[model samples]
Target: MMRSIFSAIIFLVLTRVVYAIDPRWGQGCTYIDRTEQIYCFGGEPFSENSQQILVYALNITGNSVLDLSEPQWTDIPGDPNGIRPSAASRFTFTGFPGTDTFYIQGGIVCTSCNYNSGFKYSVSSNQWNQTNKNKPVVDASSALVNDILYSFGGQTSPLTGYDQSNTTYRNTVYYINAKTGADGPSVKPQNETQLPPFTWASSMVYSYVYRSLFIFGGKQLSATEVTASMSDITVVSPQTGVYSKWKNIRSTSGSLPPARWGHSTIIDSSNRTVVMFGGCNDSGKAMNDLWLFNLDDAVWSPQETTGTPPTPRCRHSVVVLGKYMLVLFGGNDGTFNSDINVALDMTTWKWTNAPTNILPSDSSPPIDFPNSSSPQGSEGINEGGDSSSNISGGAIAGIVIGSIVGEDSSSLCLRNETDI
Candidate 1:
């Protein structure tokens, strides 16, 4: 009888240790070099609504460890009555240099409602503070350059009502200072520029080596039709109080990934290359391919990888740790959400799954937000202004087959799915 009880207790302890880890997708992740931790905020479970803000600290003795074991997640405490940003996706999070504060700006609150407000979170205080509320409501591409937050093309809410398909798409540029914590005058910027039409969901990464921002695929729409994927690569350099004109990059080597939005791009300043991965095409099928663009030579090349790659996904968050390691977490696979975390070795172009462990007893549960739903419907660039709806199973099958053949072939037609 004593042996039986001891065995049962051992089993329970083992199960608890294994089950302590929680997986999530669609959350925004950023690495804090000061804390040697990665902060992840706001995600969806199985494509449903979830509001979780947690941090994971690396298990390294010092800064010399090359391979890192998966760190446990700890919930950050927020003020009970203080202002907090509503849970949302497609937002941009930029950490201020030499500080523990990070800023979240412009995201889709609902299928038709995009937010214009900005919020800041201090890692040291574990609190959130509302900043500017008058910023443009955009689900667009943004990058931080020289302590200035620059937001580019995205869609605006329609004045006529909740028409998701007929909203206005913008290529205008706006900037705001990152150090200010108030929402009043300091949040607004006088620097603004109008450019050619560019749609939402594009990805941008600032290259300090080149002193410019590189923009990848986004969609373009008109009253009658939408261009689902864009092939042109645009580079913007911000000058004193203004940004230079958008310059299209001419590729001479390998083919570009099918025009896509909801993808991620990160710059490795040490290698002088921009790494891109996983986004959906017009047909709404997720992708798992990897590609790299050499900034010095202006060449795009497909990366052949080894080991297991994350499943095809879109709207995921990725951060480069140190110079050669890239960590990607959480995303939608078109039909469902993913909680998988994967790491890539840039030197060898190898992929590996991140290790997970049980959470400690001191960890807290994520704070819940009220009245939030799974965000649906694509933002900006609706093809034929169709009503936002889920893609039929038959349409999804066709997309998979089309992707297998070729994105530029006649079999593939640019289509929009419900937004991520």
Candidate 2:
């Protein structure tokens, strides 16, 4: 089944002009623990002029043990009378905790244009409603905490056909009320004078143990200079909607991972660590190395993961389900691909194209909600279930730095300015 899926993906890439089943790249996806579904939206399709306008859902767990190699996928349409959001790529897609609603923000609309408007979607109503205009950002990273969504640095202007001469990169931070769609006032660290770099196409994840957000590698573009990739880490505490300050944390023990952009990251609360994987390196080549960041001591350690890993690629999405399983989806590797790769057992650091683990049959989810303070204390879950699972889990969408198609028929490259 895995081989067949790969074969079909290759065939579709060669023969199909439109990507309806799985988007090419730059689409965001998040897993809904309550519904046991993964929702994806807004990506560039195979046809350069086309976009993925529909929402795609994939079932992560089933009635009993399931084969992840041939997972089930479904497409959902918005309400007929509602105004659906205009199609764009590399936008932020995140679920509002304790609700069925998801919010989407700015993205690339054309080679020279970007959309700064926001949109809200409800899974129960199957609807899409345009909200207030959001901060102008494409290829940015975001995370939701206590009903508020915070977005980090990204491109504010569309790339001028691969040239950064006229492009604008922002170091500003933006926040919004996920439930009310009300924009939060501009925020700055109360105690710090410096802010995070003007970064875009980076990966970010929130740590429950530390009560802060960790942002890693991406292109750093400023008026004075342009750095291809960076290896530093920035941590910010958005305490109850207002930020306290930003701190730079660098590894002091060992060699750090090569700086890269368009990567994916997830927090492992059980181990007090952050896991990072595959991205395009500074030399414009895709990489598949895995690295772990120890939150306790600020050290970097490389992991020799077992099993044949997915092909090296960048601009992919990754999400943690249950306690230890990390599921990875579509990415761009010179060519766009639609494939599912899994780190089936994080404790053992094993990778697989096929999975045999069975989801719990009880009414409760297999992972713990990140916002809850104690077992069975999560705010918005249904009345009764085995709410005691201690595993840390949250929705993390895949991120891309937006893409620009080369003039040639076969080449698709990252937004023409950068090497990758």
Every candidate's lDDT: 0.49, 0.55
Candidate 2 regions exceeding 4 Å error are 1-20, 46-52, 63-65, 110-116, 159-166, 190-193, 223-231, 240-253, 324-326, 341-343, 357-420
TM-scores for candidates 1 onward, in order: 0.66, 0.72
Q: Tens-digit lDDT track for model 1 on 1-420? A: 563454344333322222223454445666553454555665444223333333332321222333333433445535556667665555656765446677776555533333537788876565677677654444567665535665556765542123345555665445566457332122211233323354677777654434444567766654433434334665544432223333333444445567776777765423245567887777767788887766555556777899777777877767544223344454454454443556665545677654322111113222111211211111121112211211111110000000000001011111112231
TM accuracy, model 2: 0.72
Put down candidate 2 lDDT per residue, 1-420, tens digits, no spaces.
563454344333323222236535676776555455667776665334434345776655444454455556666645546767666667776764445677787776554443547788877666778777654557887766555666677775543123334556665456666567777554344433445556778877665555455677877765544433335666655542222222233554356688888877765533245667878776657777887766555556777888877777777766554434544455555566545545455645677765544332334343321232332211111223222213334322222221100001111112112222
Judging by TM-score against the true structure, name the best candidate: 2
